[model samples]
Target chain A: MNQSMVKVFDIQKDDFISAGEASSSVKKILKQLGVSPEVIKRAVISMYEAEMNAVIHGGGGKGYAEFFKEHIEIIIEDNGPGIENIELAMQEGYSTAPGNIREMGFGAGMGLPNIKKHSDQLEIKSEVGKGTTLKITINF
Target chain B: MEEFINSVTLDKDKCKGCTNCIKTCPTEAIRVRNGKAYIIKERCIDCGECIRVCPHHAKKAVADKLEMIGNYQKAIALPAPSFYGQFPSEYSRKKLLIALKNIGFDGVFEVAAGAELVSAETEKRLQTENFKKPMISSACPAVVRLIQMRFPGLIDNILKLESPMQISAVMARKLFSEKFGISENELGIFFISPCAAKVTAVKSPIGIKKSAVNGVIPISEIYGLVHESLKNTEDDNQTNIFSSDIGVGWAGSGGESNALSSGKTLAVDGIQNIIKVFEQIENDKIENVVFIEALSCPEGCLGGPLAVENRYVAKSRLKQHMEEAKSEKAQIKPVLSKAITWSEPIFPSSVLKLDDDVMIALGKIEQIEKIEKDLPGLDCGACGAPNCKALAEDIVRGIAKETDCVFKLRERVRQLASEMIELESELPHTMNRTEKNEN
Candidate 1:
């Protein structure tokens, strides 16, 4: 919430190699900040996978990150075809990624599950055709 | 334990300070500082991803050399079960042992025997006390360290059995000293490592006081010697070379699964694959899975860092060796028992902590919030963290500060832009003189 040190990133869809780029930068920052390994790991996993989802399914997205002494917060917003069924998406091994993606070793249907697993707190906002936004926080 | 000395090293000059490894690292063990790479020893799992990806080959693996064994009176070679995968089809076990002796080693022992022993011990432990569900294999030292750092919660799942190499080294020393009437200090044991993590493991063993292994010989360096031995059957290979199918099979993934003969076990290869399985376990999703075998490298020990052949080639060679294993029943019991000792419990160490105190964690949280307000939230590595909040924590640790990132300064510039606009409107006449002076 502090006005001074807020960070922002613009993520693109289908940029596979660059999908986790923003999250990587975030993780580096967290480490230099001397955040506990546990908290930084959680924050990185949540943010990176979420960013990947935006690129893979949401078409493209934007990321916002805020650092606190004890917590790291991340927000991802995408203006793509949003989730039609959040419950189905949450299920393990229920991936909607194309076969090509699977062949590349991703789209295991564990993306959302992984994001949720790593975040201390996670919130998702999506509409079928409108867009989606994800907010994740990890307390150190 | 050797106090968890991280054997993995960083050659800073070659690092481009890119965040590639930082992003890919499962444990966030890598950090780019002052335009080079730095590894946090406490957090590194020695998984070798950075070594695999470093463009400049800056992330080199550190291991003991074969020459180091010369310092001892008697040098012994303890080849891992994966060692068989390095040779050609004609490379006989006796020939390999003979060549090891020729290479100045007094004796050669298969690490598979130790693995067999540990496997038996692990089996017994499973039937007893109510342990963490889906007990993890302790053979892979990298995996053990991974649990120590990132997945400390999963430490309960780590089987308490000592690594086969460790057990083998101890046994080799004991048996050789007893037969030869030599002092223990005069005997040297060198593990032919499949990967760098194993080398690190022996140098700094976990759950034990001192390492039995005095040095490590990377499999890659010894491959040529083994190949040469196979070509020259002219030398007498009269020395007895011992091992079994179950023991040798420990070289590849699913070898452990086959050894345990557990119907509910799952074998996952590659560090990334293991990470995925670990996540599933953390979620408690795979409930029926009783045992999990995780290899840091793909295709198990054959895919270790010190290996010479590709994983596929090594796998085929390993398979061929398994099929050729002598199946006499009488040879089974003694070899199985003598090759390994699965009696001792490999207990998990308590490394994971939720927090020293909830109040302290809370206070740190509040400070991070205040720091965030001062940050520009660019999530730039210039500040050395992923985002503003992380920068705040860095400030707490005294590693980084708010102004380290250029984005925050840009925000300040933008904020000042509006103020200058308002000042121009208020004092247009005063600006005219200063503007004329500049012209």
Candidate 2:
């Protein structure tokens, strides 16, 4: 009686045009699976923020979404420069993004904080120079 | 009152069974089966994309004929704002309305006037901080249905007021009954629509319990009669047109947003374009915009499938109508001062889901992905489905077969031929005695 379906999307560094592709795809899938609208909205916002952060701060990344009967799990992993301080990054308006990226209307430093606000359960594992991996889960 | 699921219907004989409609439908509501195109009832938003795409003129919008007006003691025409764009600029809107009244309607009420009331209400709502960001306009019935079907979460984001058509019909029914000393039931209220969706909206309303309109007539169906009556009809009165210049501007895209006068508003027209913006809205990506005007038809109602004039020419005429559009204040008032909200809330439709049970639907999703992987990914629509993926979904739903895909059918045929060849080498010993002896 196992009930689970998984989808994976590849993210590219500085791929601003396609930053929200994974979140959009996940939204469609959840809708088809009879997931509630409110849940889908939260999943989309959180995933989109993680994706933008990956593209802007983390050099490049991949998005993994697994849907279960009771809850859904999403992971956004990146191999780019990882966050040195998780607490500081989680604060609103505290951004490490370069000034040029800020001009593009993104990198307002709300990425991690916004993701935390929307997701029910969030975990972040980061290695200073190697990468950052985020695991987010939302109850159905 | 016959309960038809959609206003758009098919003329089976004229259909060539082409995939045009199935490919073009924004909701994927159409499928070709048994050499004919058919519409799925729940999924059709009645946007009339099929009517616009059908090559043989097979698709038609089911509308009320003028003859039906004889059934009522009093019949009033609630002309949509877009109705003004159907004629040349020389025809005064006041005259055009008189022509409408001359045909069969006992009275003519401008829906644009109702639109002005709605605009004022929306302006007030925009000031309240409790509303959702990027408040989506619920003016177009098709866009409202689109949100219910695809973007259910945004339903709360949709403006809560009834459309101009509904608001006008209510006001017309009230005013006409009070003015003539006639009962409301005896009064038949009809709307002049530019597209098929409005007809469906009246019949099977979404948010409201019921529509005040009794019938709907496409502008095309009654245009010729109105044109003929325009020659002899005299000016009814100075109060003939109630809507202000901005209200009449609602005929084209950006009109509703323009009527808002202030705030960061965005207008997106055409069904496909609306889908893109809705996707952005779902992602919470669109920033700072307080209101959005989304229309189903390209260039707004002027480009409706049922509209007769070329959109561009009608657009130029619309501008002229706007300039001449009445700026004078109306003398009569019955619920015309503000917009009335819908009685009920819209619930999301689950027609797109694979199954009711999450586990079962998940299993079906896996099957669809597996089947899609085997497909050629051509999206050719030769299989009577919109694309290979659609065919896969249908297969998992048990409505279609793998052989429905021509490539898959060919592969199956090749496999069967090879199996037959293998069977030829396995004849019984009695029938293959010479071969057995050689072995």
Candidate 3:
């Protein structure tokens, strides 16, 4: 079978209305590429949630997703306030976001946890003053 | 499965082509293109928010027509427990059953009976430590799909129980087929539905792939038929269709909780209410709140858009009916062994793919970084996406380009200030020459 895949995205922060836009587009590309629904859904959920974090908490960031024959990879990086404690942040319901964010329907602290749950491999690196970067890979 | 079960339909005539739905949809499910609105099947949660807000009434929930039931020799009406709230207090369960029969149903089965079974199964499952914390209710198929799309991580938490309608349909069909020697095709079970999600559930069921029920009859159409019949059969109480407790009290929000078991469970009516509970659950604040019952419809199923009476009125009437025909004891009988065996498991079909390898994904991130450096941070959806990062993801997906975003492009232009200056210095001295000639 011929394997054809090419897709890219750039994520920006504070875009509430279009927070999941890139994820949806990636989902569309995966569908067109005929990726299995299971793999596509996981990648979309993980990537989308990450993208939301970048927007809501990352101050602003960029997300790049790639579709390959054996897997899907997503990288999100931002210059926003970086994580102070990676381990504590990974815990569910440990959000530092202000209450206003909660009103907008986010900051339940499920972002990183959900990312870990859906992805085959996940990694996060951050500098408190510099920014945070998240990388997720899903194997088909 | 009916191939074209079209659970949701848009009235092209009424659609004004507004992108309101496209913008508001949590899943980006609706796409406005070619001057009309279309639901991208893979993305829609069928929350019925569209159905609720459409100014033109363009969005309609596609359900079974009453006339179609004629195809079956024997048809059973499996009314949702929410249906109890649709009539007045004076209305009798016997009359309601008679009304269904009067409208041509061979028999009527209370879905609350099915709910009773599900409540028991859920209670048993909740006692296990292995069960995912804060298990989600499967009764609302829309909620199930929402998790599948947006919160796949929480998918494990979704209760594996078959919906009440599915169970009742299975039982009702088995009983009818075995006793009367009727062919499965001749026995039709129709769910009097409250929402579009139920219609979709019947079409592409979750835990159980194929639905036992054949068709869905919207509650709105059946309400008038039942109402008119009740007035006609005012004096005659001959039809003992719904066995008291099985029929009445099923409509109100907490009725199911009350019927299932009074203690150690919680029932939340309406999507907003459920969302609040979910937030609490996420905080790990709601403990011992086992077997949370969530109804997408406010006031429980009684508030279904297709239901006959106002939700408040229906709720009151339902309470009165339950009081009038109170069941002395809650039936905890084991579900019939033949009730749908857990056979087919619904697995999510994967669709996400990485556009490149790990290194390539890294490379794209670098490019995204460069692009982010040059773009404005405003996440205004004016660029057609929800925000700048979403726009970046769109770039990676090839669905959109960085240039598609006006703010990004403007920032890019601003960032090239040095080049702009160099170009200005080298620009044809046309302006200078023109000025000299004028002087």
TM for every model, in the order presented, reads 0.68, 0.96, 0.66
Q: Candidate 1: how many backbone clashes? A: 39
- Candidate 3, residues A19-107: lDDT per residue as tens digits? 77777777655544455556766887788788888888888778887666578778889898899999999999889888999887688
lDDT of 2 by residue, A21-60 (tens): 8998888888998989999999999999998889988898
lDDT of 2 by residue, B336-430 (tens): 66898888868888888888888888888888999999999999998898999899999998988999999999999999999999999888868
DockQ, per model, reads: 0.05, 0.74, 0.06
Q: What is the per-residue lDDT of model 1 for residues B1-439, given as tens digits with 9 covering 90 to 100?
A: 3365666788777777876666566665666677777786766778887777677777867887778888988888898888888877566555666776676678877787787787777677667667766899988888987766555547768876668888888778887776668998899889988888877777776767668899888887777776665566455744554567888899999998788856889999888888768755653446577889999988888888678888889899888888777552212223234333234334333322223543444455457667887776656666555455656766765677665677866777898999999876786576578778988
Supply every candidate's count of residue pairs whose N, Cα or C atoms clash at under 3 angstroms.
39, 0, 38
Q: Give model 1's docking category.
A: incorrect
Ranking by DockQ: 2, 3, 1
The DockQ leader among the candidates is: 2
lDDT of each: 0.74, 0.89, 0.70
Candidate 3 lDDT over residue span B150-243, tens digit each = 4454566678778778887877787678756898778989999877888888887777768988998899978888778777765344333332
lDDT of 1 at B237: 40
Model 3 whole-model lDDT (C-alpha atoms) = 0.70
Q: Which run of 10 residues does model 2 chain B get worst, by summed lDDT?
A: B325-334
Highest lDDT among the candidates is held by which one? 2
